[model samples]
Target: MRLSVLGAGAIGPAAAALAASRGHEAVLWSPSGRGTMGLDGRIAAEGALSGVFPLRVAQGLEEALASADAVLLAVPAYAFPALLPRIAQAMPAGLPLLIAPAASLAPLAFEALRAGLGPRAPVGALATTPLTARRLAPDRVRIPAIRAAVDVAAVPAAATPEIATLATALFGHACPAAPDVLQPALANANPIIHAALALTNATRIERGEAWPQYELMTEATCRLMSALEAERAALAAALGYVVPTLAEALHRASGVPQGRLAAMGAAIAASGRAVLGPAEMETRYVTEDVPYGLSFYLWLAAGRGVAMPRTAATVAVLEVLWGRDLRANPLLEALDAAGLPRLLREGIGR
Candidate 1:
């Protein structure tokens, strides 16, 4: 398979490298072009994925999508609005496009945009990224771990099995079909975990202290995360989706023992795979997750008449702390909550 991976950040390069390792041809493109600048058509990866692999760096979006069997958007959630149009314009029809670590109902947004462009292939999203990695350099990546399984869903819902098959083949892991796009949307745990970590450790971030994210998951911090998770679960239940609990998710992602949230955090911290926490307040931990992630959850909760005081309060406090309205998610803003449930399950015009 030939894969076109967008974004040059940690996940993009790592994914491209992983594809190459699996004997699939991969071409990588960075929207800004800077992410692939220093790489001379080869990627160096360590940890779970090791050694150097041959990689092609496309100079433009058109070049990247040309003759590709599949397209993976590895960019951040905030980049979706701007990049989706360009992607929809250039991508060849009938080519599968996937959003890794999909957030804020991005696949639906892309589906809506693609609807006006005429017939195209299925658009899908992963509940979360298949691997946890960090960019060691322009061409180097460190993959701490690869997930055992990933939740996948497609806009039309009927195309889920096909998309999941493609994902499994590409990543060499289990890709399970979700009930609907909303299931994957609600399955993302970053917002719930990051919100508690960022807010509780604001001082550490502001002071530029290097803190290990899981190590600092004190009892209070874990308690806050549990509270947020409860609210999120309630919202998911209201939508008739029973997503995994926080502990269950952590255990699956990191191979930590499934126990209390704090106990899981402790196990992850003791494991060497723990990544460092954000060093600055403006990090995506708050900016992206708050607006694109938590805000979307709140919007859905409101439509379902579900109470999310903890979730709402966290957003409110973060806004005050950052002096910015983090809930102004353009995707959510453009959506009508009353119609979203059905919209997420069925494609546009259904």
Candidate 2:
């Protein structure tokens, strides 16, 4: 397998190393063009991979995208609209494009790609990232652990088996074909966790206080997490997707509910530093979620007349904080449902 990872961030380098270890010819590309190309040592549980891996690095996006067997969309979701068209412009119509951990906007991306390549381009979308990772050094990454399961599907449904087969060759049995790309997109779990944690810890993050968020999700915080899960689940169901229960995911992540919450926190502490996400505001969690994840989630709920007070309120607060209304952002507007047939014939508003 020949793989090209679009961003040389923590996850990107880690993935490159993992693929190299698995005997895949891997190339990494970063728009900024820094970092040595290597993977060393085995990955630790809940920590970044150790060891330097020898890998190829490309400085430019076009160089990375050219002639690659598979291209992973690792940049922030906000970067998608601008970068996607460029990728589409030069990418071969037959090449496979995979979106790592794509959230609720699969429909929009499928529409865009179809519009670009005439609905016949071979494109695959993933519901979860293949590996959990962090960059421990400029040249090295720590793969905490590969995910236990990965769900992926092709955008047009016809490409699912072919794309899943290719991905499984690189990722092993962890990757499986989903019913459709939309299922996996809606199933991606980061939005629920990030929005809740970010909103909860805004003051600490803004003040640059060294707050331990993993340890902060206490009994009380866990309760709040359930409410957040309910909000996401409601929107997901309305959009015709089923997501895993928060309790089950927590159990998988920390072996909790089987033990006391304090012990679970202790277990996470015993595991050493776990890099959850980017340390900057320009992170995908914020930049992507505002438009793709949060706005989409809110839109689905609003379309169904289901109140998403928390989700909507958070968007308002974050828009003010960020000095931008994400809902009106260019990509968000482009991806909006546009009353696609469901309402056009109803004539309810008129």
Instruction: Choose the strongest candidate by TM-score.
Output: 1
Model 1 / residue 44 / CA error / Å = 0.9
Task: Write one digit per residue (lDDT tens) for candidate 2, span 68-177.
Answer: 88877676676676766667676766667777767555434535544634534456777767777666566545665566556777755666788788777766535556
Best by lDDT: 1
The TM-scores, one per candidate, come to 0.97, 0.83
What is the Cα-based TM-score of model 1? 0.97
Candidate 1, residues 1-350: lDDT per residue as tens digits? 99999999899999888888999999999999899989898999998889999999999999999899999999888888888888878877789898987798888887777676566688888998878889989889999888888889997888899999999889886887888788888898888899889999988998999999988888999999999998988888888888878887787778877898877877887887888999998788999889988888888877568999989999999988878889877766556667776777677743
Clash count in backbone of candidate 2: 14
**Candidate 1, superposed: residue stretches over 4 Å from native:** none
lDDT of 2 at 132: 70
